[model samples]
Target: MLAERPWTGYGFESFWGTPLLLNQDQPFDRAWDIRTIVHGHNGYLDIAVLMGIPALCVAVYTFLVAPLRDYMRIPLRKENIHLGDFFMMVVLFAALNAFFESFFFHRADPVWLFFVFGMFGLRQVSLRPMAVRGRS
Candidate 1:
């Protein structure tokens, strides 16, 4: 699917044509030029190189920075429940999963979004404090 859209072309010309300009007199043939840049062999290589570096950075941040920040802000030894902390954890995981899917997979699915919402609902239900206090 990603192969279909060249940044220079209008619709389908770049993917399935003679690679010629429809309008030679114009300042530029936008479609042919963009198609050349995006679908050409060297263009693909350039995109791969560009995308790979940032992807690696994000991976490191996810596995390293996130856990470290979580540990520093919240004491692991405490048994008391904090609603905000739980919510943050849920959001972090959901966001990370979404980011991975969008970056690596190149496809969007609603299942991850559903999972995020489900986690939020479950966290809210579980963290609700009991209204009655030791009267029974």
Candidate 2:
């Protein structure tokens, strides 16, 4: 599918709405059907197919890579460690879930919302300096 439109793609809803797949002259003996496919089932691939590879790269970097890097740099305090763990879990959940679901970047998706909230929380936690509890 990407080979057909690597850059511009077939546009949104192409997964099910595209005549490209529906119009295929498949043999009558075919076990499965393309029309049954509603989504790419992989969030990253869906974005790449619907948007483009560049958009997929940007989305992955923005939502997963950068935030994970930032969270890793956070100081290892009791509270900070907990925050990092929470962030890690959220990131992992979203990342792993994307492998089988097309929920990434969906505004109304609860998982996507939680992922965004986790990213925002990580940003706030990474910004504010950890208090120097023992310092004068």
Structural similarity to truth (TM-score) of each candidate: 0.27, 0.80
Query: What does candidate 1 score on TM?
Result: 0.27
Can you write out model 2's per-residue Cα lDDT over 1-136, one digit (the tens) per residue? 7887787766776656777677888789999886668788899899889987878889889978889887877776777777777877887788888899988767898999988888887877676655656756
Please, what are the lDDT tens digits per residue for candidate 1 over residues 47-98?
Answer: 3333443444564565435544543444332331354355456555654555
Which runs of model 1 end up more than 4 angstroms from their true locations? 1-50, 62-64, 75-81, 103-136
lDDT of each: 0.41, 0.80
Lowest summed-lDDT stretch of 10 residues in model 2?
A: 127-136
Candidate 2's clash total is 0
